[model samples]
Target: MDFLSWYDWITPTNPFASLFFGVIFTVIIGITVWIDTKKLKTTTLAMIVGVFVTIFGVTILNFIGFYN
Candidate 1:
């Protein structure tokens, strides 16, 4: 019950791990943005959103002591 909720709400420990893992995600987003740019598509906004969201989430999770 509570354990499950806690697990769901809490984040993993190790901010460095989060950032390191997040780099992969960020790169993927960058690549997507690049493709979109090549196509002259409107995905740059989405990529930026993703980048910010990922960074915010990771930072909160790692820095808020929720990961512990």
Candidate 2:
């Protein structure tokens, strides 16, 4: 009946772990970008680069059977 108990279910062995972290990171980045009005362009460009890097990194990891 508590949040920690529910969070305990999302372990490294769980299939949703990667997805959960990915969503969490995306949300964090979104919030940072939303709050910084002065450097929005630079921040967004950096986020785009980060996204591409993550995509390629995950694809490479999966291709090499890192998950298995």
Candidate 3:
């Protein structure tokens, strides 16, 4: 199944959905960054920034009536 359908069991309003996906995304990004650079600091920073930006950006989009 596709990624969208993978999360179908999780209702969008559930806070855990966001937390779970955020951690999952962060871990994925961390692995990719580590494989590419082999640096723990860089990987950590990239994962944190990526997760923050993604969540913040989505929140802003929803605020501006983009998601709904």
Candidate 4:
């Protein structure tokens, strides 16, 4: 399957995969927010960090076939 096909499966067609990815995404976001809070003490900054970290992390995982 190509990237868009895989994206469709994980995003909507498969509930299990969606939930699994959601949990991993949430965990990544939570960790980034926690670490950023320690340094910046700013919710907005922490949220930004979390979003970027999660996006990059998921992209890397997908590239490595972890999400396939």
Candidate 2 residue lDDT tens string, 1-68: 22233453344323245444555676578668768754877677756766666566666766777656
The ten-residue window of minimal lDDT in model 3 covers: 1-10
Question: Per-residue lDDT of 2-52 in model 3, one digit per residue for the tens?
Answer: 234455345443334454566677888889999999998999899889888
Q: Tell me, by lDDT, which candidate is best.
A: 3
Q: How much is the lDDT of residue 24 in candidate 2?
A: 62
Root-mean-square deviation per candidate: 7.3, 5.6, 5.6, 7.8
User: How would you order the candidates by lDDT, starting with the best?
Assistant: 3, 1, 2, 4
Tell me the tens digit of each residue's lDDT in model 1 across 1-68.
13233233244345555655565666677687777576435456656676677789877876667657
Q: How do the residues 1-68 of candidate 4 rate in per-residue lDDT, one tens digit apiece?
A: 33234565445333345444655566666667667666545645655665566567666666676654
User: Cα lDDT of all candidates, in order?
Assistant: 0.61, 0.58, 0.68, 0.56
TM-score of 2: 0.54
Runs in model 1 with CA error above 4 Å? 1-12, 39-48
Worst 10-residue stretch by lDDT in candidate 1?
1-10
Model 3: colliding residue pairs: none
Clashes of each: 0, 0, 0, 0
Q: Could you give the candidate ranking by TM-score, starting with the highest?
A: 3, 2, 1, 4
How much is 15 displaced in model 3, in angstroms? 9.4
Total clashing pairs in model 1: 0
